[model samples]
Target chain A: MSLNPLHEIHTRRFSRNLGLGLTLGAFIAIIFGLTIVKVSRGDYEPPRAPTATEATQ
Target chain B: MSDVSINSPEFTGQGFEGEAQFGDFFALLKPRVMTLVVFTAAVGLLAAPVPVHPFVAFCAILFIAVGGGASGALNMWWDADIDAVMKRTARRPIPAGKVTGDEALAFGLTLSAFSVVFLGLASNWFAAGLLAFTIFFYVVIYTMWLKRWTPQNIVIGGAAGAFPPMIGWAVATGGISVESVLMFCLTFMWTPPHFWALALFIRKDYDHAGVPMLTVTHGRRSARNHILVYTLLLAVLAIATAFTSVGGPVYLVVALVLNALFVKGAYDIWRRDEDVSETDNFSVEKKFFKLSLLYLFAHFGAILIEAVLTRMGMGGWT
Candidate 1:
């Protein structure tokens, strides 16, 4: 039997791996998607700059 | 037949003076598996009833992730020979000769100790203890002990994969609750069908590798039957979790929809004729496997949504 290249092993399970990988990728996408939604919904605000009096104190 | 005993270490110093690149070492961590662990663990942390210091939560997840990676490295070291024979895992670092067994063992052990100790410092001993136990269960119980010995390995050994969420909860609450246990049960019950579906399609790989996966030992018909049974049980447990503390209308709806699809996919797999060959593409088995992935992430995603809603005082029953 010819030696199988190491890369081929991962390639061989492409569909199966993709099925799992896509789930994780989708989770990441959902996180970013939610962040966008939250921002759009005005749920997030930038940290306020300190007043000069508070800063001096 | 080329077979190496699991207890013995085989170090092939084959790749450039036993030197491995960063990617090779990283591959030993099984990044794909780590992704699942991290996501579930993060969900657990976020979904907890108690408040946490954001820094503490981050550290807990980071250390837990390190512990998870440690388990992967150790598993790779032990299963290198078997990994080499299976087409699905032949490219793994140790099996591919990119990293040697000795290196993997040392790397795994070091990270394991570091993760456990620092996690205790960052969070609570309870979470750290759970993390330590999760690593032990994966490496010692599942990989070394059960995997080669029994066809029911994945069924019994799936506890390792299910512990992360509980560990994450402990990180926040320093104790267990009905909600955490329910989450654990959801993942635990889901494991068999998810893995068995993959096994249905890749049965030949296990045959070649001499691993005693259910498919290889009992044949395809039994594996299919087992998948259907487990998926049915998982459906009940998953849906029932919706009434618990961590769940609400969002989680309940998600559980209702996904579990229905999951049960249907499993039924389709069960109805397949055992003699159905690979040339037909094992389409049903493959589709069921894909559905299984969504079954998990979607449930956890819903739980996270419930947590967010509850934080906003819009969750659970009145």
Candidate 2:
């Protein structure tokens, strides 16, 4: 008996898979871009170290 | 007998029918409605006094569009029953059997949560909260409660569609102001007359679907009178907006011309009886409906131009 590797369901659902893949990829790109913008804008900066004068005070 | 034959009773018993494609899922988002969302939101963002980074602005609009699309999915999910009955909506994804109601519900809820969270992270919580409220209002308040119960459904439900610009403004300004309120008012006021004109042309769809549209409950002449009255009120609000911070000389001119045409259209709709409308195949009503679309786009476009010119130091009277 010969074995077939491809299934008909795969062909029928290819477009849906591709679309979901593209949508997820785009979401990742948006997140990366947003992270860069927020970081560059100091939105996620750690709190600054206290100065000795301030610490003494 | 071939096991792969789709026509076989065995294959039919396996229950693979009307399998949705990528386009079907996208249709669940109501892309046509998203265009209005994207446009109005962009206008609100740009028309604000503060400047946003281009990429950030892009993110804000994208998330707002997603939020709007999420609401559309929810609307389709909830209204699948009515949609199946109405000629205008019978072909929607859920009603047409391409996408199941459960699938639509899951899709809508997921996108709603994602959009609200991402919008809060991308811009501000105020805008995100507004978007969240908008989804709730559209899905719950309007779709679930108001739509089937009252003839004033469109009047109140219009608020859902009117919110994008306000969300856009809040994204930029991080708060609401008179400017954002005015923009919201502009869309809010324009919606009733716009929809009533459509109801005039497709009254039977609502009648058959058992939806309490103004035309269904109040009657055609009453709907016409409502259209005229709303158009007059909308014209006053629209023209008054020309003096606000978002408006300029260009907007004033556009508003003047468009309002005149809109009022004329409404008047024409009001003057005609059903006999005349039927004779002309509702051509005047159809023309009015088309003009309503142009009226909105032109108004927002003019505001966008004013914003651009203001940035260039050539915009408003100031």
Candidate 3:
């Protein structure tokens, strides 16, 4: 084998690690999907100001 | 300096040394730490009362992650000297001579400026401000000032890691709240005990590196005592969190079970003898450390589940 600098002196695990990175990206996409679906369906309401009973002791 | 090939694509000039690979640059980002930052920050964002636009939320998380990677890079650059000494860290990009310290410093600073500026534009200024402070705390306070100065380094340094959730919360609400503060406190309190467990096994590394970890300054017995005390406090805080706005049946159950197991693990560590025999091998300490990872993830996972359920209108006290 030709002595390639990349193969020696440093570790390489790009394919496996890249697979894991994509999985993380997919997970983030799922969370984004959920947030969009919830908001578009009008399922989420903005929080309201505290009521008198809630604000008081 | 030794590996600098004059014509290599990885070489940039006077400073660039060695055939720097993609993994080398990625290592500087400290992806493992970034994972925790992203996961906890996501939970904090989802658990907040206010709803965030999905695209905006994505931008917020992406910037927060970049900021987190910035902190890790800065930490590596600053801690490279000590990292070179520790057996566990001897092969890092800097110590292994894969990347020069100067390059790491530039990489960290560029990412820091990039992440903070874009975060301010993408999210509220408050969240972006917290990100900036988090980076400063990790690099300046924790890595530089605290690590070598005192045994309580991890205790104070833990705050840097704890800020991600609060930053995530600010992304949604544009301000702080009781829930966000509680989440920060949970991570802060859990850090010492979690780290000290690893310290029990690796105490010799800190001793050799001259880092004043609690295990190095205090004896093994004292470290065990501190872990027990901290674990008790952590259990109380975690269980109490189950009753807060983010809490529900799902969270309550997870909290009860995990806290019980955690306390049991701490107690087991405390009861361990100072000396390790052939059969002992520090497995108890390692097992506790492993469980501690699960402990945090389980709590955050529970919180995320509660948020999803609430979004579906099937959650909260009912």
Q: What share of the reference contacts is kept in model 2?
A: 0.34
Report the number of the highest-TM-score candidate.
2
Candidate 2: tens digits of C-alpha lDDT, residues B161-190: 999999999999999999889888888999
Residue range B4-98, candidate 3, lDDT tens digits: 45345543443343646667877989898889999999999999999987777777887899899988988889889989999999998999998
* Model 1, C-alpha of B11: deviation from truth (Å): 18
DockQ measured for candidate 2? 0.37
lDDT tens per residue, model 3, A6-53: 643334334436756885797578557656765786657887899999
Candidate 3's displacement at residue B65, Å, is: 1.1
lDDT score of residue B114 within candidate 1: 86
* Candidate 2 residue-wise lDDT, A1-57, digit = tens: 221334444454777999999999999999999999999999999999999999999
lDDT of each: 0.84, 0.92, 0.87
Worst 10 residues of 2 chain B by lDDT: B7-16
In model 1 chain B, the worst 10-residue window by lDDT is: B6-15
Ranking, TM-score, top scorer first: 2, 3, 1
- Whichever of 2 and 3 has more TM-score, that candidate is 2
lDDT of 1 by residue, B1-318 (tens): 432321124322222333465667777888988988999999899999888767567767878988999999999999999999999999888877767899999999999998899788767899999999999999999999999999999988999999999999999999899889988888888899899889888878999989998888888889889998998888888888889888888999999999899998888888878667465888888888888888899999999998889999998765
Query: TM-score (chain B) for model 1?
Result: 0.94
* TM-score, chain B, predicted structure 2: 0.96
